[model samples]
Target chain A: MIGIIAMRDLRSLFAQPLAWVVLAVVQGLVAWFFFSGVGRFERLQPQLSRMSDPPGITDITVIPTLDSAAIVLLMIVPILAMRLIAEERRAETIRLMYSAPVSMSEIALGKFFGLAGFLLIVVALTAVMPLSLLLGTSLDLGRLAAGLIGLTLLLAAFGSAGLFFSTLTRSPIVAGVATFGLLLFLWVINFGGVDLGPLQPAIDYLSMLDHYNAFLEGTIGTEHAIYFALVTLGFLTLSVQRLDAHRLQT
Target chain B: MEERSTLIEADGLQRFFGPTQAVQDFSFQLERGEILGFLGVNGAGKTTTMEMLTGNLAPSGGRIELNGCDLLDNPRPAKASVGYLPETLPLYTTMTVDAYLRFCARLNRVPKADLDEAVATAMRRCGLEDVAERVIANLSRGYKQRVGLAQAIVHDPEVLILDEPTKGLDPIQVREIRQLIRELGKSHSVILSSHVLPEVEAICTRVQIIHEGRLVLAEDVSALRARMQHSSLLLGGRALPAPESVQGIQGVERVERLDDGRLRVFHDTQSDTAEQIVARAASEGWGLWELTPERKSLEQVFVDLTGASESEVQDTNEEMAA
Candidate 1:
């Protein structure tokens, strides 16, 4: 049943121009950033060789592109995830689904997987830019793979928030706005809590960027992996609970 | 052996939204090949009750047995045996009719081996074959409604619950959907909710009327019509002594003048007042142009049982919701 709904959502995603447009726009911007980083690396190579220990191409070009890709995902993912459940409710088509033999868990997980599939495609598109360095220079495959894994987890966490917010309302616009607000709040919390003495460490630990920055440095930690997994699981559980409560409400 | 199956047994169903009791103590039994019409005015909780029956809403109180399976205990297999179409057509307008129906079929657990045949059969039954490849958004309102019906029956469930199946359709489309419902009643037990009395009279075998979230009347359609017989009389034409003279006739308890100058006489259910009125009119030298017995319409029965018009009740419900 989860496969059925996930396949349907994926098919609908590819059927519309929004997915293609978002993919194209985000890829275009990332490619421009990638080339600029490469050009800067080309110009700075002479000065970098003079130093005993110089910055490599991966550190200058690949890490920055990955970080920018993270920021781009924060902006584009809400648009993709907003329609997962909210649009169905707005159109009243969700009544058909809820009335069917499928369970609420299946519905939530199916929609999560559907959006995950789309995000994977976007992640793959951006990963290609970093891997393209292999044609001319020896690249750090381990670091690039670490960054890709982190990027996918980060998007999945954002996707979970989008899914959870979408289930909270019937309007897709509201879902999109709420999701963006949540991601923004999560993104800036560490900076915002800097002055709140004693609570600063707790807030910093909750910040998503803190965990993501480690991955950009070509390192993966157990705590960072656990944080993303817990965040993703928490929101997906909230989505399931919201849908179950809705069955009783409606 | 021609054995009928008992498809659904709902008992003590109750739903409350805050302090408003939407449905209370609702209970009924449905049998195979039975088209049961659920009649009520707007805001009378008809849709709420249908939602509970179809497993879209959980009843605050009560238990529903679908084919002997307790609904709350095992909803999947139970719901798989039932098909539902809500009042508002639930459709994915972006998908082509063929694709949407197939998606619905798979969601309802129709096996992949028989998916094409099931979709084809449902489309053929709903007259959606011509528009099967067209996007639902591009189809006309009538065709979209047909597609909604097609999706509901794509799995060929043993029970079908339809909420206002003819709403918002042109007369021809309404007639077509009603006909399709009647045909479905030959094999599936159908629970149809509507405020339209004529549609119920034309398609349903049994009728249950709900008012203010309670069942007020339930019986066979033929039995309800027959029960009205011998209780009312429609007397037309002029009487030399005036219309009130029919009140003096035996078995006539009340007489009122209709808009068309016809006399509407209420009498004891056990008596034949029409004969007495005709004999009295002839002897009194009255011009007896027409003396037809008036059987109570479902509308009259509805109004009498609910103590308000369907539209009026609907208005009150809407106001409360607002």
Candidate 2:
């Protein structure tokens, strides 16, 4: 049933004119970011190589693809996930879904996979820029792969959070806004403008940006992997519970 | 241990939105092969009851059983048997009608082998072939409604629960849907809730009326008509004798003169013996006006059943427990 639902959802994604436009915009931005970030890094590499032990100022070729991908993800993903349940509820189609034999878990998982599948395709297409980098510059294979892994994991986390917000209301716009708001808060809360005393350790560990930090250095951290996986599972479980709660209200 | 004839039952079913009880202690039973019509005003618990029966909503209290399976205890079994169409027909606007129906079939776990035939049959049954490939967003409301009906019946569950199935449609479309429902009733036990009195009178075998979350009355079509007991038989013949003579027959409760001067006889009877009535009139050499067994109208019964007339209160009380 999940496969069946996901198939329909994926088809819907490709069928829409708006989706095509979003896809084009993402490609254009990702390509620009890749070239611009790498070009700047290569120009600085000559003077940087003369210096000993450059921390964050060294060549950014490896991290640029991951950084730009995260930016594309954070922007493009909610639009995809916003329509998952909220649009159905708004259009009164969720009632049909509710009456079907499929469980809420299957529906949530189906939407996740459906939206994730789109992101996967987009992520795959963006990899051509990084692959081209191998022809011109020395690239660390392990670090590059780890960065891609971190970006995919982060996308899953965002997708799950977006799905949870979708279940909060019947309005897709509200879902989109609220999910983006939550993501913004998550990003900003750790660095400044918030109390960081008792929650400092937990907050830092759980931060979506923090989890992707190791990927910038081209190293896969088990801690990052575990944290991201837990975030995805937590949001999905919350989404399913919200659906069950709404079903009871009907 | 009694062999239950009730195909579906709700006991003390209740739902509350904050302090307002949407449905309260609402209980009723649907017998096998019976088309149960639930009548109500807006917010009168009709859809709420249907939802609870179909396992779409959980009741606040009491138990519901369908085919002797507890609806509350095991919703899966009951829900599996239910084919529900809610007031707002849920549809995916992007998919074509055929694709949407197939998706519904897949969700219901229709076997891979059965998918094509099932989709085709549902389309054929619901008259959906002409626009099968058209996107649902482009379709007309009536056709969209047909798609809604198609999705519900495509899986062919045991019980069909329709809420306002003919809600917004032309007169002809309403007739078609009613006919479709009546045809479905031949196989499946159907429970449809409608505020339309005449439609209920025309199609349903039995009706359960609810007012403000409580049951008012339930009765079989013929029995409900019998409550009035005023038979309207039109006998065209040579006008003759006194109207009082026919009124004197056994089981003849009352007689009223029509505009044509043909008398209408109200009778509570074990059997309508109009033949015996005619025979006695013939032997008396009286010019018998009209003497035919009249079929009482269900409309009159509906009015009396729900009306506030003082004289009807006693009969209403007696028929309320059906």
Candidate 3:
């Protein structure tokens, strides 16, 4: 049942021109970032050659490019995920699922996976820009793999949060704005002044950027993976519960 | 255990939106091969009741059983046996007609082997075969309605619930959709809601009139037609007698003089009032040109049953127009 709904959503998403436009914009930004990092690396190579111990190309060029890609994803994800459930409610097409024999959990998971599948393509396309350097220079394969996994998880978390916000209202614009607002807050929560008495560690742990930064550094900590998992699962469960409550409330 | 013939049974259903009760003490049963027409004014709770029956909305207090499975407790099995088309046509406009029906069939859990056949059958039944390849957004309103109907029956559920199926269509389209609904009724038990009373009278076997969230009237179409055999008679003549003289007749309750020099006589249902009036008109040379028993239309009966004043009915008509 979940597969059926997910496939339909995927098909519908691609049928619209918005998905193509988003894909083009994300790829264009990633290419620009990748080339700029490479240009900066070329300028520093001669100075680094004089030193006995110097930074490699992966540290200076690849990490910055992947880091900038994550930021780009943050801005585009809410736009993609906004229409997942909110458009269904606005068009009154949610009644089709409600009247069907499918469970609320199935519907929520189906929608989450649908958006996740589309974002997976976006992440893969963005990663291609960094991966192309392998033909000419040695790239850090392990770090790139970790970065890919981290980006996938981040998109999943963002998609789930967007799905939850979509269930709160029938307006896709409102859902998009709410998801962007919440995600922006979580992304920058760790940037507060470091003098907090006892809440600094907890706030640091909640920052999505901090956890994603660990992946870019090639250190795939279990704690970071668990944090992403928890956020993703938490928002998906809230979406399912909100859908179930819709039956009771108008 | 429920009777084998009963397809749907809703009992004592009540729903409230905050403090306002939308539906109260609503109850009805649909049997096999029955097309039950639900009649109501706007905001009379027809859509709410349909939503509850289809498991889209949970009633505040009540029990609903579809095919003997409790809707709230065993919704999957119960909902599997039913299909619903809400007041708003639910269509994914980006999808082609064939793709949309296929998706609906899959959602309904139609077996893989029979999925193609189910989609084709639904399309053929809804007269959508010609528009199968077209995107739903490009179709005309009537065709879009057919696509909505096609999706509802794509899985061939036992109970089909349609809320105002012919709502925004021209006369020809309305007739076509009504004919399609009648054909579907032969195989599936249907519960339809409509403000077009004649459409209900034309296709439904049983009629349910809902007013103020209550089931105001429930009767067989034949029985309701019997009730429509009104006791009033329209009397037209060149020279009519005084109203007091017609009131003097036995069983004649009162006489009303119309603006066109005609008498409308209200009489007891049990008495032979028409016969007596004819005899008096012949003897007194009243020059009666026409005397016909007035048959109350379904609209008049609906207004009388709901106790809606003339202006209120006028308001309802204007609301429907706009």
lDDT of 1 at B117: 99
Clashing pairs in 1: B42-B314
Instruction: Say which candidate scores most in lDDT.
Output: 3
Chain A TM value for model 1: 0.97
Best of the two (1, 3) by TM-score: 3
Which segments of candidate 1 are over 4 A away from where they belong?
A: A192-197, B1-4, B230-232, B238-241, B244-249, B255-262, B275-288, B297-322
lDDT of 1 by residue, A1-250 (tens): 8988998999899888998999899999899889999998999999998999888898889989988888888999998999889998888899878878899999999999999998999999998988888988888889989999999999999999999999999999899999999998898887752487888878888899989998887889889999999999999999999998887883
lDDT of 3 at A115: 89
| Interface RMSD for candidates 1 onward, in order | 1.2, 2.0, 0.8
Give one digit per residue, the lDDT tens place, for model 1 in B43-154: 7789998899888889999999887777899999788888999988899888999999999999998999999999999999998889989999999988988888888899
Whose TM-score is higher: candidate 1's or candidate 2's? Answer: 1
Q: Candidate 2, which CAPRI tier?
A: acceptable
**Model 3: lDDT to the true structure:** 0.91
What is the iRMSD in Å for candidate 1?
1.2
Candidate 3 docks at the CAPRI level of high
* Candidate rank order under lDDT: 3, 1, 2
The digit string of per-residue lDDT tens for model 3 on B1-322 reads 4446999999999999999999999999999999999987789899999999998899999999999999999999899999999989999999999999999999999999999999999999998999999999999999999999998999999999999999989999999999999999999999999876778889999999888899999999888888888879999987799999999998999899999889999998898999999999999999999999988765578687888889877777775555
